[model samples]
Target chain A: MFEGVPLTWFLIVATIMFFIGIYGFLVRKNLITILMSLELILNSVNINFVAFNKLLYPQHMEGMFFTVFVIAVAAAEASVAIAIIINIYRRLINIDVERIDEMKY
Target chain B: MLIMRHELLLVIITVILLLVEIFLPDNRKHTIILPSILLFFIVTVLGFIPGPTGELFGGMYATTPLILTMKNILNLGVLIIFIQSVNWLKKIENKGKIGEYYLILLSTLIGMDYMISSGDFLMFYLGLELATIPLATLAAWERFKEKSAEAGVKLIFTSALSSGILLYGISMIYGTTGSVYFREVMGAFNATPLQVLAFIFFFAGMAFKIAIVPFHLWIADVYEGSPINITSYLSVISKGAAVFILMIILYTVFYKIALLWRDVLYVTSILTMTIGNLFAIRQRNIKRFLAFSSIAQAGFILLGLIGQSQLGMTTVIYFVLVYIFSNLGAFGVAGIISNVTGKESIDDYDGLYRTNPLLSLTMMLALFSLAGIPPVAGFFGKFFLFTAAAQKGLYLLVIIGVLNTIISLYYYLLVVKAMFLNTSDQPIAYFRSDAYSRIGLLMCVAGIVIIGFASPVYEFILSLSHGLY
Candidate 1:
């Protein structure tokens, strides 16, 4: 039971993790790092989902079911993203995001 | 009897394609592809019959006549894409890998089918990921090309970022309303500041897909960087499904907060059109130019969204139908040229009519249709969208829309003049396009010319709607 733990604690922690992931995504120049940040952001959402399930809607398993689906989707996304990153690396011989602008404005 | 008839057919087709990949030799792959294309077309057509609309899986899955019609339109688009890509797909690097292309494409199509027919947020999110991940792979399908790889990188990261933002918003919505079902969400649609913030984030997520002005940074880059078929797929099919789903969600789930969304859409419509047109004028690359043009078209679609009436939605559907034809025709021309001479910029079209009159003519008509010239379906589409907005007393918005059309006309003619009137001693050599591409182009042209004079298609599109307002 999450009796002693306030819902606010989960929400606040989740929000902090979400912003940190966003900050890394925005500022990071490495492709792999950006992807890791993306994973972090998705995981933060998972945390929010699970917390909401435990706190608010334990009767229905919708939130937990959604969290599982999100995890599966994140796995698919990460696999594809990494495959693309590696493909880019083969062409440019580097994974630097700044150098990947071959078709920029 | 299975509830999701089309999805079941799609899955069966996917399995057949995968089996074809396994059993067929590398050289014999092309032979099986045509049959598979025919099979997909047949199954999709057969699946078009109207059935009982039902909600299965406790409102997670849904079926309706409108969803069926939209799915059929998407199938039609994919069939054409198959035709359009055959010539490109037959090249050396892609020959044996044809099955992979169809696999990813069919999987993405399945995702879109799910996205449109979903009754709840969970199904929508899963379907979206299923569609998007493969699309990013397809964007970089040309593995050796640095540009294609760059496009793949850009698409995946942008897509991941948007989905992340969307999930965060969805999480907040769940926390507040304690439900993700549209039926339940509508009941709890209180326009609190927190609710509005969540809605804004949710809209932002969809906006990236629709390529509205603010989140449109990825459009031109990805369009220019990817191969032509993928560009057309992204601009038309993917965006079409996203726009269709966005309309349904706003109309059904967020209908209670109509006033809030209408105001949000009004400013978005005006800004989207003006800025899109302004940026389009400066484009040198043909793909990027069309990218901006599509952004402007998104603005016009948003115009129809704000009218808050069935007539408004009818206008949107009509415009999208016409838009698919017009935009694909333009891209088909670019694809042919890119294949023949590898020229991509607007300047490369100089004196094209002198060398290749047929393609040049097609290009001219397509560009005219895009510019909303009379006797073309695009003119009617835009006319009706503006009228819909005007009927809602958004006169200033209509005026901006018209002005954007005029500005768009100028850039479209820039390519036209270069193709027909400009003289060049060394124009691109005349080259014969493949039979499949020619058929695809012919379909686009026919849709553009005939769908305009004919009134039945518009009426049918209107009839398809059960009533959003």
Candidate 2:
């Protein structure tokens, strides 16, 4: 079941995007950037779901439905994350992950 | 309707709480507490009623005797938390937001209920998000507190990240199998390289929720920063729900790769148990102490899972039931003390027995239960888990589990020693916990004392788990 754009290409791009997300998550100092990285990770997964559905299994709509649910859930998660970020900014006057360690062992 | 009775009733109660809050005046915000607990208590009791059990919504939602029992266990734990939190919620600092707290908590419970009953990964994803996102708000409930806000940020960030990984794994599973339904996926699953990678991602995401070793860093801070009641909810109810779902999925959907996952569990279990025990040893803050101990408990739960049969499922569920009682008892005493005295350190607990003998006795029983000492429910829980693992002939893992149990006993005894043996000039002053909290603690104590000697409870779980594998 070959197509104009191969499934391997899509998988490669998603993998790259996913790893970039992992990198940003580990390296980012600011909370909003980390949040963005999370979105990147999720969006990459959405790409994988969509491509896998269209390319590998066109007869099934489950992956498409899953992608839609994921997008909706990711939005909700982003709103909650931003609320938390704004709250952290209000309380600590910054959203730097390094400076937020008040309860370390 | 019959299948989702638990979630439906919980949602209705949340709406009732919300409407009641709007009608009630400001000074009487505390009144919502009683109604919330009463309504939730009714829901908990009603959950045990025999009901229709089968597939729903094109097999997206399902329930069985085992799933009903799991939901009932979660309901019972949340009800106790509602009762235990009454005093904290009544504080002036919490003021008008009391209704929102119950609503958010109820939503999370609903999420968990759906997650537990999910027949398809789509429903599971929705329930997982519903269960998780509100909890971030709860972690940062005290938005003005720096640590609380930090905890919220960390929790949301990590949970979002983990869910993303989990979804990616689900995408792969869907790609390979062309279905997200558990039954369909299980039939098509294989030990292919990509499927193995997908399983690992799925396991890691779940490990984050369960607070296994690699993903447990966020737990201590979150537990300490959140309100004491939220902390207990996270550790007991939230963790229990995740464990139940993970066990179900592993035993069913991933049964094709049991050997692969068992090896993974064997390594992670040892790391989780040893690391959790070691970190728990030096914690000064009681919340952090319990945080690490609960992580260790999660590790022990893995031993039961590694057994990989009907007996494994039985022990894991049984242990979780016992754990909820034991851990909640410990946190109830700690919460009451913290709420009344604002002293949260081990040092502050010195000479506690002199002033408050009953609280001290409760703490001692809780600690003993945690240490898996004979006569309490935790010992029986651990004993059964060990027996299940040994039945599978995982003798070396059992030995390490036993060793970790010893290490855990020492730390638990340290708290016991502080409360009963250590002396200090300025001990916490005696104060009576509210009647509601006393009732909650009493329930926990009763559960801990009674569950061990009750063979019928084990038999019931075993019977329910008979066809799980």
The CA lDDT of each predicted structure is 0.88, 0.91
lDDT of 2 by residue, A1-105 (tens): 545999999999999999999999999999889988998999899889999999888987888888888999999999999998888788778988888888864
TM-score of each: 0.98, 0.99
Proportion of the native interface contacts kept in model 2? 0.94
Q: For residue A81, what is the lDDT in candidate 1?
A: 91
Clashes per model (N, Cα, C within 3 A): 0, 0
RMSD of candidates 1 onward, in order: 1.3, 1.3
Candidate 1 clashing pairs, residues 3+ apart or interchain: none
Off by over 4 Å in 1: B1-3
lDDT by residue (B1-469, candidate 2, tens digit) is 8778998999888888888988999888877777788888899889999998998999999888999999999999998899899989888899989999999999999999999999999999999999999999999999679888878888888899889889888888888888999999999987789999999999999999999989999999999999999999999999999999999899889999999999999999999999999999989999999999999999999989999878889899999999999999999999999999888998899999999999999888988888899998989999989999999999999999999999999999998898889999999998878898899999999999989778899899898986555
DockQ measured for candidate 1: 0.88
* Interface RMSD, one decimal, each candidate: 0.7, 0.9
